[model samples]
Target chain A: MSENLIPLEQLQKTCLYDSHVALGAKMSPFAGFMMPIQYDSITVEHNAVRQKVGMFDVSHMGEIFVKGPEAEAFINHIFTNDIRGYEPGKVLYGMMCYPDGGTVDDLLVYREYLANHFLLVVNAANIDKDFDWIQEHAKGFDCKLDNASPRIGQIALQGPEAEKTIIEVLGYKEAADLGFYTFCDVEYNGERLILSRTGYTGEDGFELYTTNENIVEIWDKFLKAGVQPCGLGCRDTLRFEAGLPLYGDELSPEISPVMAGLGMFCKYEKDFIGKETLLDQKAGNLEKKLVGIEIEDKAIPRAGYPVETPEGEEVGVVTTGYHSISLDKSICFALVKKEYSALDTPLCIRIRKKVFPGKVVKKRFYQTNYKK
Target chain B: MSKILDELKYSESHEWVKVEGNIAYVGVTDFAQKEMGDITYVDMPEEGDDVLAGEEFGALESVKASSELISPVSGTVVLVNAELEDAPEKVNEDAYGAWIIKVEMSMPSELDKLMDAAAYKKMIGE
Candidate 1:
């Protein structure tokens, strides 16, 4: 009964609202937008992406453009990842952080076709906040920042057969040759679209960004070609199964990328926001760390559930958990005390009134099938 | 539209109860299963555990969120559908057919306070 009490009138609808309604999708308010939670079933859509091909309406994700002579310097100052040596068509996954190392948002930085032109794809909920934060920091830099979230629409074609679907359905044959973490700008039917070989799902996939009208055309084309239309429900499940971190769940203002075990994305050689704190944590001064907890019981360990020791001492709290659809096991990510984060460390998760015994395991319950 | 049995009693919280003599069977309504999307797990109370009217006895988990299973009548749990422990999707398949618990009703009079199928249909804006 504890649902969001926000009025439906206040929510914004995407350009594909009519399409989703025509497909009999279940619409729900998410991140200030009325998004499709499911069209058929979460399991069915999830399996489609895992086994064959599926497309998701990801237009709610924010797209910010940074361009100028100081663009790379400005991005490197805010982003944790090193972007100095990235080619024009490269994409890097990293996070923007506060001075204390807490994450502002985890994003994908796409180096555009034009020199010194970079595109930052951020979470839907953090669009406005991230834009304001970036604008505030750009005062010192000479980069021109543009918040293009409302002007663009995105679709993710994901699965083992994603490349084939893109070629056969959208007629974008060049996508078949794109390398991992690379992108290209193509003009189709007089419309410019950015196709990137990067996805949140651990599958061989591509994300297409274009104008709203072109997105609608592409969506219709995919639907006609029999590609499954996925929703936010399976999107979370797919990313979770692949051990990818969700912004509000696994990464947050209180949780650092280092604490979340994403230290590799943070290059210590560059001095970015939260560099000092992250460097100190890398030297083994952190208190809590994220770890995977797998429960033997069928009862799921949900978010905010207390993680405890066998004798009832509270150790941490679950950030995200589920009875994994693919793995068929109750698994979760918890930010536990650093000492208890080691593999094989026994832990307990309190589900409702019962405390189920579990053990610390690798976060990846399902092995990724990303086409390297 | 979800199926609503005319002979069954329903709660505002979407629980359905079928009373027979002193025993009553409880399960989530079809409307609830549809609203919940897919049923991943059902947390059921142990046999012989006491439950009061309108109190939460267990929960039903879906992919998105968990919904508390509120008791429609006061009773002691006599049996639980153990099959749901492994095949929770059965509820999504047939909500009424997949009864969650059988209770030995301590007060069968509580059934009179619940709505009938007609009232439940109207309450859900059908």
Candidate 2:
């Protein structure tokens, strides 16, 4: 009927495309970018980074700067986390929710300078929505918000050797004392950069933020210094093994953070948008509960697949699914009926045309490495 | 990788079966496991399960994906690899050594429908 191939729009390239291609990486589409899924093999790359060290291109994440006389109050009113209580150089993980209590995006709020400004790091896919949301809510406040994503370059040095790699690269003795979730200004090649002791992978790591002009030099320097070049495939497996949720699969517009097992981020004491609906749901009106299921048989649980009770009644759907390299099982996270949220409950997933039996396990299939 | 001993038969899906008298031994090809990444779980039919030629009899779970195991010939399952229950990675480590199940072939001549190692290799673009 149509001669046109429904031509796909050109994809935006990252700064590391050539580098990844040279390493014989398998590239795949992710968040609108052609990203490397694996270099040699997913398992080899995953174990290499976990046992040693690795680096990830994290420039895709969105960063915003909020500054002004009313920055503190404005941020406190918007974020679910208590921004008023955070100290300078501290980062707090939280979410921005809609008025109806649905999560817009989970973000990390970094208190930069004393009460004057702060930085917010958000997921890559939600950058536009996050920026627009902040602007729409800033009409009555005296705060100024700026989308600094394009200008900023980010890299994550992760694994057991993360601290040593970052300290050596930046040549900062004070960086050794940096605590988890804390950031500090560092001088790298005469350029001042913000280095935070935080990362998405379940490893001891640091996320470095600097100008785009200096990022290529930094990436090259890290690779030369033996920070193994890692790809997004390993990143996904590492985070999944650590039981962290990906935004598109775990955090969706229709799903609430509470239903995703992140209710601790929601605060009733704070008078913010989405409070009333969340409060009503918290009062026992919630319908579905997120549960983690591990397939007892060999069948894999995949996203969008139907999950049902042993008796064949549809209970819910799989949100995220994968085989766990660490646990040696096919694991999945599903939002099932509240009554079926019990641990160790037998369940079945309809994959293709066959029914595979599974059982609910702990939300975290693997132990997290975050320092308390 | 085991010698795809010429006596055995293969399927396009990468399964290999060796028939001796009325019994057969089944295992996946080296290419199958390597392409599937790390094997986390292997579901095998029980000792008394019935299998039909071209019908799926079991499944294999790999990191980030899952695959089905189809029968090469109609038979009754006589033995299964119980070791896979604890160490499924063995399949990835050595696919030929980790034979999934053994069966008593109903139609021994059905093996003629399968290809040899050379033919199977060509189909997968080896």
Candidate 3:
């Protein structure tokens, strides 16, 4: 049967399901998995990461492995980022796009311990579609592709104190020395685990990739140590505050990385899928671009709200928005007409029956505190 | 489990009306506020605006989404809860006490169409 026909009640659950329930988490279905939306509260969970340390069960994220002598070439053919000289244990954040430059999914490609073997972490919602796309394009690549999503479990330990917490709680002291965007394999309970200094919250953190049983053990250790168990609700707000792009919201099939102000990740030197169209968009007059808007009123600007010019011309729509928990301002990321996306451009957000005045500003609402 | 006042009339939309002769006080029910979670803003109609029965008068915004506030009786808005503009959390704290608006009933008989507290409880599966 097709994926869509699957019933909502039959949604998958991560290995940490019982832990979340025991902690009084509000469970909701997201990306085909029954995930925790909030544990104590969104505000509390969000502040925990911003102030101290928190862990998120990111097990629902899919992991696909590609291995062969031609793995790097095959990855370069599908990915926008240039990974030709990437050393083992390096991680590159990039997108896989359709031939027409539309996004398939924004993902992280991790060079594994073994040479010529790489792991791709993709959004859970796009697992089947992305795997199918990868297989369809791998016909002539002389590489093997394996969907290892179900077998892999992931957790992100995030915040300023994440390094200390990981060392004290999980007994993974080597995590402290791992460079940003880099991963290393460490033995845990007689099994190898991948620990990477990467996170979506733009904080100093590390993500752990392991088996379900090991992940459960790690979660128990964190729980025993009083590390905050964050849910998807705060995960979004934290990532939003850090100006990270969510796949569906910021980079969709219609919204390319370039249009989303993520052109840096799209290396033009590499000949990949949609490279021609991306180069054309970079050189030519683009129609729309992503920008940040700050409203003067306390009234929040939410997703799908219409963005208009002072003269009432519809220019864009909000993809994600919130009365930011940390900043305490009503801000949003909007895809607006190219001409109207410049900083300090006065705009109006049509929310409900009234139009509130706003100004286009830097997309990064809050400064990120990543340990370089 | 939210408290339902027996004296108040309820709308299917989860608004409560405390009628006093021809004038009625309108507010979202406790159950509504509980479901909304962390009320951030309450958009209310200005005084003297006509609010038709069973029509959207304004909206109540929570942290996650916005919910439309439907008027249970046809009336002209006489007073809005101005405090809600700055302190919307009052609705979440005390949904029954934080009345949203006061309306002069144009069709007093519209109250007949509303459910009593007992009916409202049953409707909510309480």
Candidate that would win on DockQ: 1
Q: What C-alpha lDDT values do all the predictions have? A: 0.93, 0.81, 0.91
Model 2's alpha-carbon lDDT is 0.81
- Residue lDDT tens for model 2, A169-241: 7576666788889998876668768889898878878888888767778888888897787788788878876
Instruction: Give TM per candidate.
Output: 0.97, 0.85, 0.96
Q: Over the stretch A98-162, how does candidate 3's per-residue lDDT look in tens digits?
A: 87788999999999879889999999999999999999998888799999899889999999999
Native interface contact recovery, all models: 0.69, 0.56, 0.12
Candidate 1 chain A: 10-residue stretch with minimal lDDT:
A1-10
The i-RMS of every model, in angstroms, reads 1.0, 2.5, 1.3
Tens-digit lDDT track of model 1 for A271-325: 8999999999989999999999999988889999999999999999999999898
Q: By DockQ thresholds, what CAPRI class is model 3?
A: medium
Position A358, candidate 2: lDDT? 87
DockQ of 1: 0.75
Across residues B75-109, which tens digit of lDDT does each residue of candidate 1 receive? 99999999999899999999999999999999889
What's the iRMSD of model 1? 1.0
Please list the residue runs of candidate 3 whose C-alpha ends up more than 4 Å from where it truly belongs after superposition.
A1-6
RMSD of each: 1.7, 4.1, 1.9
